[model samples]
Target: MSRFVVTERAVINAPVEQVWEVISRTDRYAEWVDSAIEVTDHHGIATVGKTYAERNRTLGPLQTRSVWTVTEIDPMKRRVDTGVGFAPLQDVTNIFEFERTKGSDGGTRR
Candidate 1:
């Protein structure tokens, strides 16, 4: 299969630390991620080599469970995870980035 990258961007109206608190919680992905239905087996803290289980729905009635491993993490900067159960793709990596913003409201641009 061809290698490709998919990116999603959003602007959170909160401080960098505030945004990091929510984003760093891997178990809470189901609350914000459109495809994530549930998350389990989270190790509580985010660090290299942590593993978690997630339930995802990609299309109409198409659901999947993937065991994800934390490959890299940079607090308040970036986080990377690789999945093992995503078939046809061989591998999948997800990265989240947080950038501090300077605006009247003074929040974060994620």
Candidate 2:
């Protein structure tokens, strides 16, 4: 098997606080994540050692269930989680980082 890492960055048109408010809730992923079909189980908050389960979309007309455990969190800054059940891709780690910035209009951006 091969190992690789994928990184993505986006400048959200919102403050870090606003973004964190949504992302900090593990149960809300299905609302925004395209691949997340539904949150099967979650505590409604993100905290180290907490776990959540989700039904996810895999490929064309394919789906799978995954369970994830929160590993690290930096309040309003970063979060990391490790997951299993997305077969052929073991030890999947998901990381989210937020940075506050000023938009072109001088408004908050994240």
Candidate 3:
């Protein structure tokens, strides 16, 4: 087995449903992801079991293409994404977690 270390974590402020709406839209990756990352092959066919073209750079001076799919998805619990684009980052698995709670003022905290 290989050891990998993660350096950053992303926090999106939104409800699980709302977050899913944004994340599940593979066609919108180029819009939300940083410039270093790009998403392609997002045509009419959608959802898991579909291949997505990806290009990533500025990752320790390493760049590669990866084909990814929805893999595992749970509406409110989490979504797991894996890379399969024949890139150095291939086989990469990302766990996107979702949680919500009530605030002191009776408002929701995402």
Considering only N, C-alpha and C atoms within 3 Å, which residue pairs clash in candidate 2?
none
RMSD of each: 1.3, 1.9, 3.6
Model 2 lDDT per residue over 15-107, tens place: 778788899999999998788999999999898999999999999889999999999999988899999999657889998877777555322
Top candidate on lDDT is: 2
What stretches of model 3 exceed 4 Å from their correct place?
5-11, 43-46, 60-62, 85-87, 104-110
Cα deviation at 17, candidate 1, in Å, is 0.4
lDDT of 3 by residue, 16-82 (tens): 5676677677777767766327775764324556667777664577777766666776766666667
User: How many collisions between residues are there in candidate 1?
Assistant: 0
CA lDDT for candidate 1: 0.82
TM-score of each: 0.90, 0.91, 0.69
Encode model 1's per-residue lDDT on 15-74: one tens digit a residue. 888888887787787888787889967876676898988888866888888888899888
A best-first ranking of the candidates according to their lDDT comes to 2, 1, 3
Show pairs that collide, candidate 1.
Answer: none
lDDT of 2: 0.86
